[model samples]
Target: MPLSAALLQTLHSIVGDKGFTTNQGEIAPYLQESRNRFQGHCDILIRPKNTQEVAEVLAICNDENIPVVPQGGNTGHCGGAVPQGGILLNLSRLNKIRQLDGLNATITVDAGCILQNVQLTADKADLYFPLSLAAEGSCQIGGNLATNAGGIHVLRYGNMRDLTLGLEVVLPDGQIWDGLRALRKDNTGYDLKHLFIGSEGTLGVITGAVLKLFPKPKARACAFVASESPGHLMDVFAYMRDYFGEQLCAFEMMPRFGLDLVLKHITGTTDPFAIAYQWYGVLEISTSRPNTNLQTELEEALHPLFDRGYIQNAVVAQDLMQAEKIWALRESMSEAQKREGGSVKHDISVPVSHIPDFLAETSHAVCNVVPGSRICAFGHVGDGNIHFNISQPETMEKAAFLTNWEALNEIVHEMAEKYEGSFSAEHGVGQLKINEMDRFRGGVELDSMRLIKRAFDPNNIMNPGKVVKI
Candidate 1:
């Protein structure tokens, strides 16, 4: 259904001429997320300033039976931020750090605040906000929470859902529900905030949030180690857990192809090792306690593995700069791959023990399905999440390579399912994975999800045709 003139006038009047724009040129950038797979179209773009304004805009849209797609930094890979049609609600102006309670170790912020800016603000107050990702500089808190983002720090602080305490949302009917209580333990009947955390805006539009903070780490040690296989990495994780315990901050895995791409594409990025290894794992240990000897503990734990031939080589960062340099090589992987060619990326997770089997089996299956495809699998090994991405064969045309994406996804997902792994891990099921969700997610789970969707957004106006199909 098309939006009526009266409703457009109401939306325009609420946001003012400066905020409302129907210009395709102006709205072009917001149509697609970082992945560039799912593109959106909108009747008009709405930029509401505050919670009240957001609620009013939503209310008017709701009355007119218009769908509303809430967009933040537009940096999402899952296509959750892209609008289907109707109104595109831009939350960039809602950027405000409402409060920073140092005593309680909590910070309340608007949905539009860029993730890196949030980290910086927390750092200024001598605290740590542990949700660090490559898109932190551009991705907004609302998008992060919407996707329940799991980044480099999931080994320590956990995902966006765990880090968040409360959320302020504008419901389908334009009513505001303020659950912004900064409580660590709340014995409430139902934890409603969890509903919107990773709903991908299907439930409601997240406007503001109260997030947990941590004491800043005083010391850190990082290393890039060569693992014989994913199993060897698991063994290393056990060793780190047995020794460093809570200090083991991150454990990331990298396939040989992923590392090679980064070193080849990104100038100045070098391989930490002289010889190419089948698998590599980057582990970091951080401590808030001053004078903690984390580096010594890491070396001690690796001594046995080094002797046993489980790990081929290892280089521990001696200083902060060196640590960042080593991390830069790992972090540049995705961007470097993008520069190289079209990539079919999957953010999937399996059990820690099954990671080895999943990797080996999925690699074999995907390559067999699409021969010459390069498997560049890597991600947070601590949480068992693998960014199992497939790179186009160097000889193949971009269009021809991308034509096999769905087939490649099938091969990867089949093996993942065999390991009892998720089809979509960190990235939410936006428009891109709706079909995957229909196939993979069970009837009971889908029914429950639909029930919640119906409860909050019965009219199907809030991010319609996303997460689940009605």
Candidate 2:
């Protein structure tokens, strides 16, 4: 149903003419997600300037029983931000850095602040905010916390949930829950901030956040390693973890096919070795203490792996430029896959020990289902998260190959369950994996989620048709 003129008039009064737009041309960008998998329509796109304005908008929407979709950056892999109807609430205008407490090592900022701007803010203070991702340039901090984003540095720093100290959210009923306490330990009650951290905007609008920061690393080292197989790479990872301890910042794995894709499509990237190997690993170690000679230590660590034949070859980057070149190959995996053809992507995780068997078995299963499919698997091996993507065969049509998306996902997700793993690892369950929630999640676990959804959003006005369905 279209929003009534009276309700629209009231909403317009709360946020002036600049905050609301009904023009389709101005609203076109917010209607589609990055993947183009989900396209949405909205009666109006409201950009609230502050928390009070957001509360007022939500209060009116709730009173009218209108569906509201809160969008942040719109960079999510899942379709969480895509609106089904009613109003689309975008938090882009609420961009502000509220505070920076050096003594407490926390920085407070509004939801719409771009992620890269936050990182740069911390850098200027000689502190670090480690929630880094490829979309940091445009992705908002609210979206990062909403999705509980994980990136390369998760091996050392942890995800957005761990990095967050507190949040300022406007509840579904227009009540502002100012739980933005920047403390190291707060045992006052149930950690309410946690409830909204990974909720994907179903509960409330995350207006502001207080996040933890760390001392910037002064010493760094990087290496590109080659191994015969995934098993050997795992062995190398385990050894590095034990050797480097907390200094091991990132340990990423890449298959030979994935590297070839990057070299072929992405310019200025050359293979790190003279001869290609079956599998590869990118290792990074850093310390906040200056002049730590991490490169020499990393070089010494590789000698033992070569002796055990776990690594066929290795190259330790001697300078900052060389290290960045090595990391670029790992970062370019996803874009390169797109250049090939249609890709059926899966973000999955299992026990770090089970990755080798999981890959071997899942690869066989996928090929059997779609013969000639190219399996391009790579991700954070240290954290056990693998992006298992399948490219269509050269002879097959892209649309025809994508028709197997559901079948292929079922096969891979079933395998992940067999190994006692999660179907949605870091990517939150938006509209894409709602069915998987019904399939893999059930009993008290799922029931409790639905109960919380009903309790928090009784009107079902907050991000309707997302996360949990009541």
Candidate 3:
């Protein structure tokens, strides 16, 4: 709905000159989705300085039936942050470390606080906040919590939903719901924070949150192991987890093709192993205690893989720099993939035990549908999530290869459903997978979701046409 002249004047009065902008040049960055796949437009973009200003703006928009798109750092991949019209609520100015209870292992931060900054704050206090993502440097806590972002450390620390304990939200009607309790166990009527956590801003605007923290790991060890197959890598993973326990913070899998892409496209990237192997698994074991000898524990546990012929070789990082370099290969996969052209990325997960079977079947099915499609499959296999991305065939045109997005999504999602997996794993429905929510989610599930959305946002002024359609 277009903002009335009176409404625009009133909004301008509420935020003042520094807070509001109608200039397209200044608003250009906030209008684009991360992949350049979804481009949205807005009449005005407002940078609210505090919760009161946010509430005031939301109240005006809600009263006028104007949609409000609450955005963080605009680093989301699924177009959740993209605004169609009405007001774009830019929360970057609201970034402030509200509180920190190091003794209790809890850190309270504003919605727009950059994730990397939060990590550093925790580190400064001799604690750790484990909600790490690739775009952590720019991705805001609000977006991370809204999407319930899953990252490399999910296997050890859980997702954003788990890391978050409480949230302060600006409701659809402009009322601030302060549920930021720092308690570990609360037998409340309902877990309201979880609703807004993964709601993708459809329910309400997440203004602030109290996140859980953990003791910083003092002893750390990393290994880059080569496996003949994913199943074999899982075998080694099982053994390592049994021996290393909670110290196994990360277990990332990378295909040879993925590594090759990084080596070719990204400068200063060197092969961890002398000879390229079919599959590579990067493992990191760490503990708060010093002199844990996690390296030996990981090494001994991996010895059986050779006898089973699952793993052929392994390289343990002797220093911090080498460990980082080894990790760079895994972290560089997505950027390197961009150079390959017309990539169809899937952030899907199956049961930890079923990963090998799912990969084998899904790769076969994807190949059947798009023959010669170069598969660049990798991700956190310890937690069952797989970044099953496919790059376009070298011979195909970029536009021509992208034409298979729909067919390819169906094939991959159907296979995941057969194995009781999600079509959209960590990345929220946003605009990308809203249609799939209907195709995959049960009727009762969809109905329940809509019912909740209606109960909270009957007018649907908050983030319209995203997540679930009412």
Candidate 4:
């Protein structure tokens, strides 16, 4: 059904003329996600300035039965931000750091604040907001909260879910749920804020949040080492944790192919060591106090493995710029692969013990299904989350490569089930993964999700046809 002129006029009035745009050229950018894989067509794009404006927009849309898609920086890998022929309610204009309570170690920020900005704000106060990602420069805090984003820090700080103390949300029917209390121990009830954190805009729109902060690290060191397998990496991880439990900040894994793609496409990059091994592990250690030698700590912890040949070679970054150079190689994997060809990406997780089996089996299955396919599997190895991505064979056509998406996804997702892993790890189940969810999610689980959707959004006016397809 087409929206009435009066309803569109009301929405335009709430956000003002400058805030609304119907031009296809202007709306086209906001309609698609980062990967350019999922595209949506929206009738209007509304840039709301504050929580009250967001509530007003939702109120009008809800009354008129007009669906609304809440979007942030629009850097999501999943189609979580794409609209479904409705209004694209962008929160970028709502960029504001409401408060920074140094005593409490909490920062209250508006949804649209860039994630890196938030981190920088905390850094100025001798604090840290440990949600580090490759897209932090472009992604927003609301999107991070929406997807419950996990990055390299999950090994020590956990994901976005653990970093967030509370949230302020605009509900489906235009009511505000002010659950933004920054108390550490509030086991008061059902923990409703969590439901909206990873809900992906199905239940409501996130307006603001109170995020947790940590002490800034004074000593830090990064190392690139070669491990024989996940098992050997696991042993190394266990050894490090025994001595530097919380200090071991990040543990990332990269297959040889992933490293090759990075070296091939990204300039100013080189091998960290003299020898190129089949598998590589990037590890970092940090401490909040000064006068600590992280390099010495890592060297001591890894001496046994170094002697036993479990690790082939290692390079420790001498300075901050060198540390960043080492990390740049890891961060450029996705884009480097994109330069090669189309990619099929799966963000999944398995038991810490079963990562090797999952990788070996899934690699074998995908290769058998599509011969000559290049696999670039790399991600946070500490939490067992692997971004299992495959590039089309160099000789194949892009159109023909996408045709095998379903077959490849089936093989990988089935193995995820066998290992008792999640098909959708940090990336939520947007429209792109609904069919996969239907295959994996139990009937009762789906029914309960539906019940909640019906309870919160009876008319289904909030991002309709996303995340379980209400």
lDDT (10s digit) by residue, model 1, range 1-470? 77777877888888898789888999998897787787789879998889988999888778778888988998877788888788899999989999999999999999999999999999999999999898889889999999999999898789999999999998989899999999999998899899999998888899999999999998899988998788888888778767778888899988888888898899888888888898888999998889987777777778888987779899998888889988998899999899889889998999888988888888888888778889888998799899999999888888999999889888888788889999888988888788887788969999888898999988899988888988
All candidates: CA RMSD in angstroms?
1.3, 0.8, 1.1, 1.2
Misplaced by over 4 Å in model 4 are none
Off by over 4 Å in 2: none
lDDT head-to-head 3 vs 4, winner: 3
lDDT of 4 by residue, 221-240 (tens): 89888887767777777777
Prediction 1 global C-alpha lDDT: 0.88
* Full ranking by lDDT: 2, 3, 4, 1
- Lowest summed lDDT window (length 10), candidate 1: 293-302
lDDT of 4 at 346: 92
TM-score for all models, in order of appearance: 0.97, 0.99, 0.98, 0.98
Q: Sorted on TM-score, highest at the top, how do the candidates line up?
A: 2, 3, 4, 1
lDDT of 2 by residue, 211-325 (tens): 9999999999999999999999999999999999999989999999999999999999999899989999999999999878999999999999999999999999999999999
Give each model's whole-structure lDDT.
0.88, 0.93, 0.89, 0.88
Clashing pairs in 1: none
Candidate topping lDDT: 2
Give the best candidate by TM-score: 2
